[model samples]
Every structure is written in C-alpha cells, then in structure tokens.
Target: MFLFIGLVLFGADRLLLLLESRGHVNWRRTGRRDLSAEPTARLDSLLEDPDRRPVRRP
Candidate 1:
C-alpha cells in the first residue's frame, strides 16, 4: 500500500511539471505582438462584451 501511494504521488508531480514546462515553452515561442491586433483581438472582444453567449447545455 505504501509503495503504491508513493508511485502515484511521484507520477502526479511529474505530470504537473510536464504541463507547466509546455506552457512556458509555448509562451516563449510566441510571446510577442502588439496588444492591438489579430489573434488576441478575439480575446479583447470577449473581455469587452458583457453579454457573451453561453455554451449550449447538453
């Protein structure tokens, strides 16, 4: 039982580190752009709209 618990904890810690590393890599690869344009333009719009449509409930 103790061995099983140790393995699970170790696996979870590794997974978290992997996810965090990927995010950092992605940001580094594409972290530059004027705050007033294209891809992020949608983000700005979302932030501005107070009544954005909600996702349909399944």
Candidate 2:
C-alpha cells in the first residue's frame, strides 16, 4: 500500500511539471521573472527582433 501511494504521488508530481511546461500551471520555482528589475541584453535582443516573436497558443 505504501508503494502504491508513493507511485501515485510521483505521478502527480510529473503531471504538475508537464502542465507547467505547457503554460497551464505555475508550480516550478526555476527561472522566475523579476518584474521590477531591468531587462537583460538577451531579452532586449529577442524583443527587438521582429522575426523571433514567441508563438501564442490557443
């Protein structure tokens, strides 16, 4: 029973991570944006490049 419970928890964790990757959830702590800080050079370049706009999902 304990093994089954552990498996279920593991599966749930994986599902949450998958959702986060697909922009359906916000559970991860890595690479979070700091809105108050100045934009980095890499970000600025990406923004200025008209051919590199991020695709929006429907």
Q: How close is every model to the real structure, measured as TM-score? A: 0.40, 0.48
Please provide, for model 1 over 15-42, each residue's C-alpha lDDT reduced to its tens digit, 9 standing for 90 to 100: 7677757774333335575656655446
Which 10 consecutive positions of candidate 1 have the poorest summed lDDT?
A: 24-33
* TM-score, candidate number 1: 0.40
lDDT for each candidate structure: 0.67, 0.81
Clashes of 1: 0
* Candidate 1 segments exceeding 4 Å error: 24-58
* Stretches of candidate 2 exceeding 4 Å from the true structure: 30-58
Give every collision pair in model 1. none
What are the RMSDs of all candidates, in order? 9.4, 11.2
